[model samples]
Target chain A: MFTPLTVALAVAALALAVWCGWAAYRDQPTKDWHFIGMAVVSVLALAQLAVGIVRLAGGEDAAEGTVIFVAYLAAVAACVPVVGLISLTERTKWGSLTVAAGAVVLAVLQARLHEIWGGGGGA
Target chain B: MAPETPPREPRDPGGGPSDSDATARRASNAPARSAGIGKGPGTLLVTLYGIFTVGAASRSAVQLATRFDEAPLAYLLSAAAALVYAFITLSLVRGGERARRAALGCCCVELLGVLTVGTWTLVEPSAFPDATVWSDYGMGYLFIPVILPVTGLLWLRRSRSHGGPAAVGD
Candidate 1:
């Protein structure tokens, strides 16, 4: 319902995508900056999960298939945590990069989800 | 001081074609157990491939199950493409002599699939209604399917030497 959460998630995801691309372009290990960017993405993703569920429960229909919308929400929601866990096990810069990149994918998909709910394509 | 990636040892991608440092880095994707399944680029590639496999498979299934009669050729091609994605994912995660060969073979097939299917889709529009993984050179996926094999072939070629038992799946 509220776009604040969606906007936040998309923004964070976009920022991180940019950051990660820069890091990769420089051929550098993902660093503290990467983690910070990822943290923001993760928080926003969680918010999306919360808001999406509420939107769905409020009798709103997903113009792009409710099942797919829910699936995308769940995917966007759990992606950060799942990748975070995996990254923790690695303890390498690549681990951070992995998590960061995962968030970028999540954000991209979340935008798509919004389009689905709005009955439109990407902005 | 500016951050820098560690100096990478020059390597190979196993039994495939082409050559490049970028492709060689895929060789670092150690077997699932030793390096863990999520270790290097291979892990990421495998995960991405797995997602694609799922996406393609579900798409085909949904299309076929709901409206098979509408576009049988397109749906069938979707199923086939999904199978190829699954096959490539399996071979990568499996990582053994057999797996390597399987991956190599699949990569080759994937290339041919995209090429033939791509050309055919344009030549015979009547055949495909919507789209398939290999349709019009994977236009839907931005040709990632087409590019994947070339990368795969190069990676497999580079991995051939150090690719012995270390390539075995966990």
Candidate 2:
């Protein structure tokens, strides 16, 4: 629910998307470094999830209702790792592109999270 | 994984060395066939469809559960879209001649659904109290609902051709 964290996660996600897209453009598969990038984004997303849960427990409410907000948080936390695993299975340029697609989706979800909270939970 | 092992060539049993060599060369040049439909760009398509499956299914599930009376048609359409996406995603992962054919057929139906829903929403916006995945040609989801089926059809056709080698071996 923190403004800075949401923005940071979106930025990190988009950056990861661009990095993975570049790898695909170079006709390369996802490498160890790309997984590291996924980890970085995942960590931030997990932090956001934690913050959202704690805030909800503290009696704060999301504008879009608690259930959907929590669902989005859980989804955000799970996105990158699952996509990374899928990419790991296929060692080709398309694997890189898959990660890129996942990262872009993560960024979109992050924006929606902000909207779901009514853009009012600023730190 | 597996240390990126070289693609295995099918045994020719009584074929000459030159024939085996040529087969190995061909196999290396087109590994997509051996790897199945889930390889190459299909990997990306599967990922996208997987996401859409989760997105549309969960969204419709919630909508149908909470407000079935308000917009039953739209929510039901959303659920249908989710099923189509899930089927395609599974068929891609379960690669083979039969799975490829099933996916191709589903892709055509999906394309038709999107076009019909898109036009219906445009021509009569008041009819839909809420948007389905295909509403306005998937404008809500960046028009991916329309584009995905077309892409899936192309990929399926290409994979079918690539399956020729594997088919002969089977």
Candidate 3:
């Protein structure tokens, strides 16, 4: 895994989380800008997924099992889009809160991905 | 630009929409006529339960498939937790009177599972070589497992009370 990219993804996710959380607290629906923010975060996550896969293809391995690492990568890549769809189903402020929660979960997953790559075993 | 209009006065002391208008709008736009358990805040709860269902199921499945011999008890408990979460998620999304009751029963079972497994793990550390979802009251998953059922039960009660006059008399 690319450490820098992973850290960047985590930071971006955290930023988006805080932004969405504030919007939810204000009882505001998720606006267009929030979708844009989600897109940016999703791009970063996809990039991380690609990089992780490339490293594995080149005979690199995570400290944990390759299957688990790849699973995390796939899950992280899918998280934002899935959450975005769920958010669309909800037009209220709760939609924004759902996105906020998704962002927080993504950030947490990113951290776990980093730990897995750095030889940390099962979380 | 046209001349600026005067700022509108706040509708309520809380600076929100008037209660009647809000209620009327909500009634119109709500997903269900009766505003079943899956509306409004229930959406958020469903999302959360869905996430946990995936988390716990996948974790336990991987563990059982790869190394079940290492900790059968733990993996089995994890699988059980996953099933409970899955049931609750489905029930919440389905959101009828029956579904609400199912979810309530599941939440009660979940709370019992968490408390039982939590105390068991503390009292007999050797029993769980690996952690289950309810182990240590879900300390690994930030205790959301422990808190979720409680929140679910409360929401179920509130939704029941608000269900209708029929529910009130029952």
Candidate 4:
């Protein structure tokens, strides 16, 4: 994994999570701005995914097992979209909270992914 | 979806309703009338549980498939934790009186499992060559395994007080 990309993804995810959490605290449902934030984060994750796949195809291996690494990659890639769908199903402040939680999870996963790739970062 | 309507209180046959009685009825019915376990805040809870179910199940499956000989006990414990999470998630989404009871039972079991396994892992590090979901009180997963059941129990208790028509209040 690219360290800079990973860091960027984690930072973006955390920023979005905090924003969503603030909105939820104010008793607001998920708004267009939240989706936009998610889109930005998703784009970063997709880039990371593409980079990871290319590296794997080029015969690079993660320090951790390839299977679990790939699984985490796919999970990170899918996280935002899945949470977006869940938010749509709920049209309350809780829905925003759900998205916030998802973002936080994604951020944590990104950190784990970095460590799994032998980046030596703390989780 | 439209918000759930409160059920009308059964009228007294012999006399007109007093103001205090109507107030009492409304108060008692308020929370019960809100939503089933599958809706509102319950939706968010179920979503979190669902994520853990998938995460724990996949992790154990991978560990068992690849390195079972290394840490069979820990891997098996992880699998069991996954099962409990799955059951609780299902019950929460099912969201009837029966489902609530089932979830309550599972939550109790989950709390016991986490406590027992967490303590055991701490007391005997050699026993767990690898960490299970409950190891160190779920430190690996932000201690969610330890916290989830406590939150679940509280929610279940609140739901019970709101006692649906099919629910037998404790």
Candidate 5:
């Protein structure tokens, strides 16, 4: 079950990925461009983390809280920087492809995190 | 004939560079990777690997640290896989003969890890009470864990013959 925010972030990332792909077709991806794409992703991830915590705090309970919580933390930290650094180093089309890949991964993880919170046995 | 070495130029200016010369330039530039920028996809792949390493390691760390009792086998394996991802990412970024060799090793292990864990879990469900990154051949991550290593190895092999700095991807 994807949250509204998740859907929004995913869609935004997808759109950016498409644009980045076009940019790659054109050539050297500047750092400023990479920053814009990643900043959005970073914000969304943090929001998911916060919303996740709030929901968890509500005490719905059932899933393995330890595993779920830890995965959530990992998911949040992992998505943002990895994508950013990869783009920073890559000044060509592959960088855009990489961003696209990361975007896809981020969207998927966001959904997974949501499921973990909703208790689909993440822990 | 040795592959033509494209002059060491990181950024090509202006519009769609789909020409054969441009294509050749991009292709030939595979080994020249050192300090500063790399081609886009290489950048992205390296970044993705780095992310995977961090995410996997943290998950393994937390899993092992908090409750080794829960599923020690799976958790320990998860930690090991995370280390491999990190190593591969480093090799990709480092872009050298030795780094390439290290990446090759990591990729081989990754292939083995996914197969071993994935098959073990399926054949004996009792073994994997919880999922690790390689559980089900990284089905959770869309099996990229299985696919990536194969691709990495091929790339490394392909780059070896060319033997140019550009082949390295920084």
Candidate 6:
């Protein structure tokens, strides 16, 4: 696992969470720019997903359970896009909060991924 | 999104000739069609439940497939929890008087599951070598399992009393 990518994803996810939470606080829905932010984070997650698969194929970290590792990798990649779609349907402050919640969950998943990768679980 | 379909009129058992006109009046008298249980805060609840459905389902699936023998009870409980979450999520999305009632009932059941599992895990830790989604009242997941059902019940009850139409089999 690339430590830098995991770190970057955690940071980006938390940043997205704060940004979307601010939108909710202001009684605003997720606008286009917010979707863009979500896309950016999702792109990063995709990159992580690819790297994780490659690492798994190369048997870089086999002790942490490959099935669970692959599942988390896939889940992290899918998180933001799914939440973004749901937010698009719900055009309200709650929609913004939904994205915020997704971001937070993604961050937590990122930490879990780190742990699974045997990164010492230091978030 | 298009406005939710206005609830259909209740059918008359006698099949009277004037049933159509009566049904039309009844439909018109019904409250706002958009007051779905899946609207407003219900959206957030649905989102959370959707995430949990995926999370718990996948987690349990992997666990059950890979090592069911290690702790069969815990893995089975996780799978059951995932099913409950998925059902509640669907019921919320399919909002109406019936769906609301169904969701309400499911929420109570969910709350009961969480409490029972939470206490069981505490009182007999050795009984479960692996943790379930409802273990320790969902402490591992920030207690969202316990909180979600209570919130869901409140939301469902609120939607029901707010005159959400009683659509038959909708």
Highest-scoring model, lDDT: 2
Docking class of 3: incorrect
lDDT of 1 by residue, A8-43 (tens): 777777777677656544444456666676677777
Write one digit per residue (lDDT tens) for candidate 4, span B39-117.
5566678888999998999999999999999999999999998999999999887665667878999999999999999
lDDT tens digits by residue: candidate 5, B125-164:
7887778998888888888888877776666665565443
**What TM value does chain A in model 6 reach?**
0.94
- The TM-score of candidate 3's chain A against the true chain A comes to 0.95
Q: Under CAPRI classification, how is model 1 graded?
A: incorrect
lDDT of 3: 0.80
Candidate ranking (TM-score, best to worst): 3, 2, 4, 6, 5, 1
Interface RMSD of each: 9.0, 9.7, 6.5, 12.7, 3.2, 14.1
Give the distance in Å from residue A110's predicted Cα in candidate 4 to where it truly belongs.
Answer: 0.8
Candidates 1 and 3: which is better by DockQ?
Answer: 3
DockQ of each: 0.19, 0.41, 0.23, 0.27, 0.50, 0.30
Q: Candidate 2, B12: how far from true, in Å?
A: 24
DockQ (0 to 1) for model 2: 0.41
**Alpha carbon lDDT at B102, candidate 2:** 85
Winner by TM-score between candidate 4 and candidate 3: 3
- Expressed as tens digits, the lDDT of each residue in B1-170 for candidate 6 is 22345533332222323435454445335655424677656778998999999989998998899899999999999999899899999987876566677788889989999999999999999999999999999999999999999988877775554444223111
Expressed as tens digits, the lDDT of each residue in B75-161 for candidate 1 is 998898889889988877756555666788988988888899999999999887777788879886767788877877766654565
Instruction: Give fnat, all candidates.
Output: 0.09, 0.49, 0.29, 0.31, 0.71, 0.40
Decoy 1 TM-score against native:
0.74
lDDT digits (tens) for residues B1-170 of candidate 3: 11222212112223234335445455434433333466556767898899999999999999999999999999999999999999999998866667778899999999999999999999999999999999999898889989999989988887665442112111
Query: What overall lDDT, based on C-alpha atoms, would model 4 receive against the true structure?
Result: 0.80
Scored by DockQ, the top model is 5
Total clashes in model 2, counting residue pairs 3 or more apart in sequence or in different chains: 0
**Residue A47 accuracy (lDDT) in model 3:** 93
lDDT of 4 by residue, A7-110 (tens): 89999999999998997777677889899999999999899889999998999888787888889999999998888888887666667788999999999998
TM-scores for every candidate against the unseen true structure: 0.74, 0.86, 0.87, 0.86, 0.75, 0.85
